[model samples]
Target: MSRSCPSRDAGLFPSEAEIARRLSQTPQEWAAKAKVLERDGLPRVDPLMGGRFWPAVRAYFLARYGLAGAEALAPDGPENLDAL
Candidate 1:
């Protein structure tokens, strides 16, 4: 008898590299922006993962660009950016 393996779901978040690519910025620039966000009391990056999840990224976009800017960059609605 063959045992079935569970399917793995794709990660629902973008990595720092992906974020940087989307923003047309370097990884270092993204990291610097992340630092500013943290200093301003936004969600901190995951220390262990060295990355931000979709919510954190969304917050960053909103904070940096405002609603209109985020809407322009997000292909789907800004609220749906993190939807899996």
Candidate 2:
């Protein structure tokens, strides 16, 4: 069955702190996961922009929680990655 989407603002990705908060994890904990994400092909860090890709974060969310869980974490709701 389809799940309810999250309520998120348009054009804004969830910050690292926000993702951590939703997962009930400390920033440090999330950072550790980010490290793994980087190793798996997500950018290590955007030196100029100062954050990882939002899609990477969304993928991580999906890996950890599945579609419904990922949607729950996304304030702006899950995106249609297929459209990208």
Candidate 3:
């Protein structure tokens, strides 16, 4: 069953509906993705917000793909920076 977020949480964060909308998925599809990503670092839904924290998800993906949070230095120098 879909539970509605109380008024106090109405706009504090994205709800499952909003998240699913952004990903072009239905609530059912979002639920499936959430389950699959649970062990892959996707943030759990904060009951208070009725959804996962969007920034946390972004951070996870960024780090997963080595896009951010890597140590500073190109081990092989700037010329080979893209290879890392």
Candidate 4:
């Protein structure tokens, strides 16, 4: 991906405080998980912009919960017993 793909021009969080705000986590909580988040493929903070790559966060969640990783949909809508 291009460097511009997930940058401040694209609404980057821009600071640890802002990142925590965006993620609904307190600063302490974010700091605690920062390393693990990066280990799991979250983009590293860019020093120049004091921001991280937003697309990486989106990509992570999408891969984890949006499509392939989620529970399968009910076969026949809400009434399908097989889905249970």
* Reference-based TM-score of each model: 0.47, 0.43, 0.58, 0.56
Q: Is candidate 2 or candidate 3 better by TM-score?
A: 3
lDDT of 3 by residue, 7-76 (tens): 5234546777766776688988988988998798789989865667877866776887888676577576
- Give model 2's TM-score versus the native structure: 0.43
In terms of lDDT, which candidate is strongest?
Answer: 3
For each candidate in the order shown, give its overall lDDT on alpha carbons. 0.59, 0.58, 0.73, 0.67
Q: Ten-residue segment with the worst summed lDDT in candidate 3?
A: 3-12
How many pairs collide in each candidate, listed in order? 0, 3, 0, 0
Give per-residue CA lDDT, model 4, range 2-33, as digits (tens): 23233444484456665666779987798788
What is candidate 2's local distance difference test score? 0.58
Order the candidates by TM-score, highest first: 3, 4, 1, 2
Candidate 4 ranges with C-alpha deviation above 4 Å = 1-10, 66-84
lDDT of 2 by residue, 14-72 (tens): 55665556668887897787678677755455566444556666665567555634333
Maximum-TM-score candidate: 3
